[model samples]
Target: MAADVKTHLYEWSTTEGSNLPVGSTVVSTNLDDNLRMIQAVVRYLASSGTVASDTTTDIGAVDATFLAVSGTTTITGLGTVSAGVYKFLIFDSALTLTYNATSLRLPGNANITTATGDVALFLSLGSGNWNCLHYLRKSGSPVTAGSFSGLTAAIATNTIANGDYNQNWTWTKTTATKPALFIGETTASSATDAVILELTTAAASTASAAASQSAHFAGICNRRIRRRQGVFGRRLLVVRYAD
Candidate 1:
């Protein structure tokens, strides 16, 4: 008697202008299927990297890169940066910083200074790759001298008039530990408000909670269904095969 061998071929399709939501099971098939799924994820991330519109209220979403500030106020939030380089995008009218620790000062040659409504960028150094260890910010008022132990350097300040706006802060993190990314919003009459801090890095020392396996193939089938649709629309497929 001869041994029997079986092979399976799968085909799926979707119409245009449809949003495909992906789940896990469909992602664990063969190397080819996995690679196609990963490519879709990368495309989604790349598309989200651009900045979005602003809002009147402080509440907003942080895409790959989008920040919006409204009114005159001050707010504080925590930033737990991973051990890698990062860019901090500030989308506000005016801002100021108050370092929480002396060691958190920006590099001397970073060229970060305080000015009313001036767009600026700062680079952090020393730790992993010049990332900030810790820091703070204040709005509605210029950062006063002696706000922190390391008062030798001038704080970066920007001023914005009524109905005017300023945005874009590109900073790099060079440390493994997380730090605070603060913001201060200066309103028209010297008053200020604060915006929330949006985190960009993945959680430290945490594992994904997804299950290892499942019996139902509907979840998996739906994933393949979505991928087939995405590939047809995007016209480009990036596949990574690993056994």
Candidate 2:
């Protein structure tokens, strides 16, 4: 009789006596195959270093677990779905990893633009599903610059819109006027202590404020406000940051 094999790992299962007396060749062959499979899984081999990425990336047929993929194609999935499988992927160049709710789930529910040397760890959840456990960038810093708003004249009260609250902000007073007092929403308090600056002179002064603190901004935009009165024309530059 032929030896039974496990489904997931493809390991062999046979009675001890099945190989006794006239040892069955089937059992021995199946045992060797299982060993090979186990070895490949444990080997953690790397690819030839030029694997082009596609929608579904193949780390390797067997042994390869660490893959360096390069291509313009956006990867949406990894190798065939099998539960309890892990893959470490390194981006050889800039590429996008699409976020999918079912097939592929990313950290922020947003597509990631990978930089060279960026690495991501993924785990298969069976049923053609993969979840990114971790993503590390080579630069070690993730910064997003938001749009800059320009003001023509000085105003009595400056309000930060709710939408602009969640970004790293750099406000510059190119015009010569600066707001005297900074007041956010009466109910809104700062999420954390962030860097606030006061530029006395118009030296193209640049100041940054934390974006998206805890909740709403209390209806105030990030502006460089000083206690002393000055001109009010300003440009609001918003930058989104991730730590």
Candidate 3:
């Protein structure tokens, strides 16, 4: 008996440097469709979008790279989205993002931008709702100046923004019996990043809660704060831990 190995294959094959002009025949099959699906994905990521102005270009349903013309941009949305479907968004500069669609959520449940040399991937959760999978760093300088603020009772980590940043601070947290560090992930997208309390030391801050209340970090990247046990009142004085 022979084993059946199913592989995604396309109906047509192309050689290197062979250009398939637009409006070419597209004969597809089940297997070929799968391959074309992948091909479409590759095409999306490979294609770049026009320099987008504020709320000018509408986000397409493919991998379209949007080069920031100015500082930030707000693109139109795909009013109707399917669950598990996503788009690959690439940026050339540090630009903010916003959507003119209803219930479309990005990282932090808000309009976030891509850092230089970074790519932001957004996934649709059906019903016109979308969320950012995360921004991948393609090239360029890493993100910096990560500082988290205090939320109602939880630590407001998203305020620090997203990027590959280095920490150079003496960590501090609220007065809790079991205090821990967590890198709150992109809201409802990626998993919550956890920071091990490896070397918690005593703090001498005027707002410090207890002797062992500081969550000092060495040098960490992708610095996004997630408030968990940092009581709103008690404060954590920090400098940068490490890069």
The candidate maximizing lDDT is: 2
What's the TM-score of every candidate structure? 0.26, 0.50, 0.34
lDDT of 2 by residue, 165-219 (tens): 5444355645543543353344644655332343233457464433345375543
Task: List, residue by residue over 186-206, the lDDT tens digit for candidate 1.
Answer: 443342421132222234736
lDDT of 3 by residue, 49-164 (tens): 54443453334332453433334555445334446655565565666666434455554445555665567676666666666667566654433333456445556555445455
Give the C-alpha miss distance for residue 238 in model 1, angstroms: 77
Which window of ten consecutive residues has the lowest lDDT sum in model 3? 2-11
lDDT agreement of model 1 with the native: 0.32
Q: Show where candidate 1 strays beyond 4 Å.
A: 1-33, 40-78, 102-104, 107-243
Rank candidates, lDDT, best first.
2, 3, 1
Number of the predicted model whose TM-score against the real structure is largest: 2
Q: lDDT for every model?
A: 0.32, 0.61, 0.47
TM-score of candidate 2 on Cα atoms, chains taken together: 0.50
User: Per-candidate RMSD vs. true structure?
Assistant: 34.2, 13.3, 18.1
Off by over 4 Å in 3: 1-57, 61-71, 75-79, 99-102, 137-243
